[model samples]
Target: MYEPFFEMTNTPFRNDIDTDALYLSSDMSEVLSRLEYAAARQLFAVVTADVGCGKSTAIRRFTSKLSKENYEILYLSDSKLTPRWFYKGLLDQLGIESKFYRGDARRQLHQQLEIIHGIYKKHVVTIVDEAHLLAKETLEEIRFLLNTKMDSHQPMSLILVGQNELWDKLKLQHYAAIRQRIDLKCEIPQYDLSQTHEYIAAHLSYSGGAKEVFTDKAIDEIYRYSAGSARAINKLCTHALIYAAQRAKKLIDDHMIREVIAGELP
Candidate 1:
């Protein structure tokens, strides 16, 4: 409801992944470093984060910065828990046809990867999203894929991205092989207080808010309620902006902040 009163061009705290609103917090930067390290070393890297914690955003940022001349990537966002469907998704991502059978599907995938390894002296990265949904047998199948290495060269680097539960599920004793193969284990924690402030300001700056739009008191309240989580903070702050607009207020203060925090805003 708020917009014209605050002179804001758009909402600031959207939960969606917006590269323009990305705040390079220290933790996110560290995770990016891990990704780069894993890619450079050709190791099997994995990143796990809770939902709405910007894991996908981090991956998108990482992919944008890669050296195109040396990297051939196949990103698969939907890989179910069944080994057969997982194999089929990989094949489809690589444009390799399968006979609709897991055995033949896997054979085709392995042969195609081997061919790619020889023909293109570039690194192959297979990014699997929502990996936490993968069943134990499916995870074992992934481990088997990792075993298909050519000499000292690992044909493909598997990067598993999923929610926090994926890490817990992977810790089961039976999945030890898959756990052991993860060279990089990184998690995205919630944003810190300063990060929250910067995050809001960055987005607001894009949306036409002045530096003085959010006072220190208001920012502190946001951080307190959001617990430094970017997702929560965005929700609260965005609502507060709308509150100000509804009240025809030009500046956000403790009162408006409390209104949002209390769920009083429409």
Candidate 2:
């Protein structure tokens, strides 16, 4: 409804943004670089962040940049996944019909990964999102999966992306084996004040809107309410734009953002 008023080609602050247009803050740049290194080296990497910190988005960006000829990226995100289903899920991604038993399925997965690495010369990168919700048994199985030819070569790059609880969970004695295997660990920090402003502007610019549509005071209010979270900032700014348009306002200001935050706008 507000696109024309704002002279935008598309709706800004959309959650499902194109990875090509993603804003790369300095911290995000470093995280992506490290993740790329881990993937290239076929290492076990763990990325932890608070909810709405853009962990999934960063991973999407990373995968988008990978070459299909050299990397086979398989992404899985199931909070209630079990050990049996975990193996089945991986096998499904690998285009293999899983065997009846869990052990058989695991062995088949390892073999397929080995073939993909050795014969096809393509490194498999497996990303497990929401891994904090994985069952202990499922996590144990993942550790064993990483044990495939550990003495010689690593066949696949495993990246576990989850909320900060995942990092805490790894600290437990029972999960020590998996923790020790983590070759790279990274976290996506919440956006700082300046980055929050840049983030809103980037989205607006990407959608062909005037980057200065949001006033300085309005951004301050957004950051105050969102606490530097990209997701929260997107939501607040989107609502603010709608409210501004509804009021026939020329530019989004502190009053519009305040109204959106206080739920005063209908």
Candidate 3:
């Protein structure tokens, strides 16, 4: 609705936006670099962030850079995942039937991974999202699964992505085993005020807007409401754009941002 009003090619602050359009902030670049290192070494990595802080966004970027010929990617995001189903989920992606029992399923998965690496020459990258919500038993099974070949190596590059609470959970003595197995850990922090301003600016620029449509005061308001979370920044800016277009406004000020937030944002 606001495309013509804003003179944009399309709506920019959207979830479906391409990975190339993601903001390559300094911290994000570092996180991506570390993730690549983990993948190359077939290590265990954990990435945790606050809700809406761009954990999934970073993962999308990292996975997008991997070459398909050299890497087989398996992704699972199930909150209610059990140990048996965890192995089954990975096996299903590998196009193999999993045995009914947990131990059998685990062995089957290990054999499949060995073949992929030793014969097919492709490294497997397995990512489990929403891991913070997984059962303690399921997480424990992960440690066991990685104990391969006299504990000398792991079969795949395993990444666990979740909210910061995932780290808090891992810190507990109950999860010490799982925590010890993590070879690399990445924590994504929310953007600061400066990043928030640049973030809004980047979105507007991506939408093909040349001039500053949002006043500095308006951006300050956005930072206050969004508190530097990328998702919140996108949502607030998109709403502000729509509201401005609806009112035939050419510029957004702090007052307009306030009105948009109260009326359009939750």
Whole-model lDDT per candidate: 0.77, 0.88, 0.91
Task: Please identify model 3 stretches exceeding 4 Å from their true place.
Answer: none
- Which lDDT tens digits does candidate 3 get at residues 1-266? 98898789857898767788877788889899999999999999999999999999999999999999999999999999999999999999999999999999999999999999999899999999999999999999999999998989889999999999999999999898899999999989999989887877777778886458889999999999988899898899888888989999989999999998888987
Candidate 2, lDDT over the whole model: 0.88
lDDT of each residue in 188-258, candidate 2, tens digit only? 99999899989988898898977778899989889998899988888788788777888888688888788
Ranking of predictions according to TM-score? 3, 2, 1
Report the number of the highest-lDDT candidate.
3
Per-prediction TM-score: 0.88, 0.97, 0.98
For candidate 2, report its TM-score. 0.97
Kindly indicate the candidate among 1 and 3 with the higher TM-score. Answer: 3
The local lDDT score (0 to 100) that residue 157 gets in candidate 1 is: 75
Per-residue lDDT, model 2, residue 80, is 92
lDDT tens digits, residues 1-266, model 1? 66566666766566554565567888899998998877766778778876677788888888777787777777876645588877787777778766687778888888888777677776777888888887788888888777764436566778889999999988888888788878889899877778878877887776775657888889988888778766677777777776777776777987679877777534
Candidate 2 worst ten-residue window by lDDT: 146-155
